[model samples]
Target: MKFSYDYIKSGNATCVLEMGKERFEFYPTFHSDALGDFVSYLASVHPLCKLSWKEGAFHKINGGITWETGTYLLRWELKRDFEDLEIKITEWQNPMIDRKGDSQLIRKVLEAKCNFNEFVLCVVKELDRVIKQRGILGYRQEWQGYTFPIDGFLDLKYACLYKKPFEITKKNNGTSLEAELNLLMEKMD
Candidate 1:
């Protein structure tokens, strides 16, 4: 699995998620902190990695992102049970239309089981690349309406690097990974 984020224009970025031959692309408009919203969703869902064994364990992550078209919205859903991670992408048509008197239909565009660990790692690596390619201030300049989510990104990165889910409150300390993370954070700042 691979994840990428590229700034395409003002207030717009193209993001891609792919595994093997299947690739899905979506545009995230930073009109009102969309990047923060999506990252927050990932941070919220990722803690499930440590709780995948709970009985009757079921988890879902849902998010809506506006597309560049201004008329279409992409609905993203991630479902996890045990070691299975099912991700679905659907197109919500005519979001501006009132649903009170009309029927709205959504079309599923992509559905696949994305590996949980791979997905997390791919996101961390890609964001790390973006940070390195574009400095911290550059990211803020490119991604308007929000700053780079370093706290969430570092938590996810530490979880992937140390092979343990570490929340912001319980960060891994006194380790090479911590040193690296701190250095990266400094560079970004």
Candidate 2:
């Protein structure tokens, strides 16, 4: 497995995930509701992992997933109020009928494409099963992203307001999704 990170913003702002065989073409897209739904899913799977939403952040107890590298803590709380939210699940699958709950960020995370592999999609599919069978939030996602440092980087206590994200369409007929992200990266630079 390999790990690489790119800070989409300043500070220690980074998107870090372990990769092996697979390549991450873009960040996972999810709906705003999915964020809360993920919290509900965790409650069903891990009976002992106590989690809740309070004080504008999500909190959880000594909870984590055992990985070969180490015990990665699967806990974090958003610093920003995620209202007026917009999330785009890259795939067209409908979550309400699929049993993955209304907030479907997990599905997007599980379906993302990497350098030469795809595990995100499989993760989403299996997570749905785990949620159904165990009826709890048993899965532990790596703690990624932080708003505090990013806030400091921008010298603001709150994040900038933005509209719901939409799928950036491609201009050419043959351009793949990867190509779109590539173009986006180039333009960002």
Candidate 3:
């Protein structure tokens, strides 16, 4: 699986998810920092690996994007068994559902299974490219609603590289991951 996001305008982006031969694209509006929300969701779930003794066997997270006609939701379901992780991606279309828990008679746009780590790495690589192209301050100026979620992005990247789930408390407390990412970004500038 491959994921990438492209900034289209001041407050809009196109997120693309490619799984083997299939490619799905979504247009997410910056109603409340769409990229931040999406990355935060990923960071929240990245710690749920079965290898982590404190984590669970199954987990689910949902995120929504405003499409041209209706709202499109990407539902991520993660199931882990011992050493394997399976990620299920389901896209739904509904005109009335705008938030994560909102439910209705939705149209199923697509459904597929993909690798969890690969998906995370793809997003990490793409986001790194975006940050390189648009500096951190520039991203905040263009993204508008909220600043880029460097904390979440770095947390996930560290987890992927080290092959371990990051500590939620540390991330929430702005300790390890946030501090390291801040120092790295400062060095870059």
RMSD of each: 6.2, 19.9, 6.3
Winning candidate number (lDDT): 1
Which parts of model 2 are misplaced by more than 4 Å?
2-5, 10-19, 28-48, 51-189
What clash count goes with each model?
Answer: 0, 24, 0
Q: Tell me how far candidate 3 lies from the true structure as C-alpha RMSD in angstroms.
A: 6.3
Candidates' C-alpha lDDT: 0.64, 0.26, 0.61
Residues 3-95, model 2: lDDT tens digits: 322222221213234445544333322212222333333222322222111221223322321111111112221111122111122233333
For residue 124, model 1's alpha carbon misses the true position, in angstroms, by 0.9
- Give one digit per residue, the lDDT tens place, for model 1 in 1-189: 778888645778888888789888777776556555555566667763332223212233455433432456676666655556677778765446444523366778888986777777778888788888887788888877678866567656766766674432323333355654674664321
What TM-score fits each model?
0.73, 0.20, 0.66
In the range 1-189, model 3's lDDT, one tens digit per residue, is: 777888646777787877788887777666656677667666656654332323442234444323332476555554544444455555565535566644654555465655667777788777777777787887887777668777666666656666665454453443454546553353210
Candidate 2 C-alpha error for residue 47, in Å: 4.9
Best by TM-score: 1
Ordered from best to worst lDDT, the candidate numbers read 1, 3, 2
Better of 1 and 3 by TM-score: 1
Worst 10 residues of 3 by lDDT: 49-58
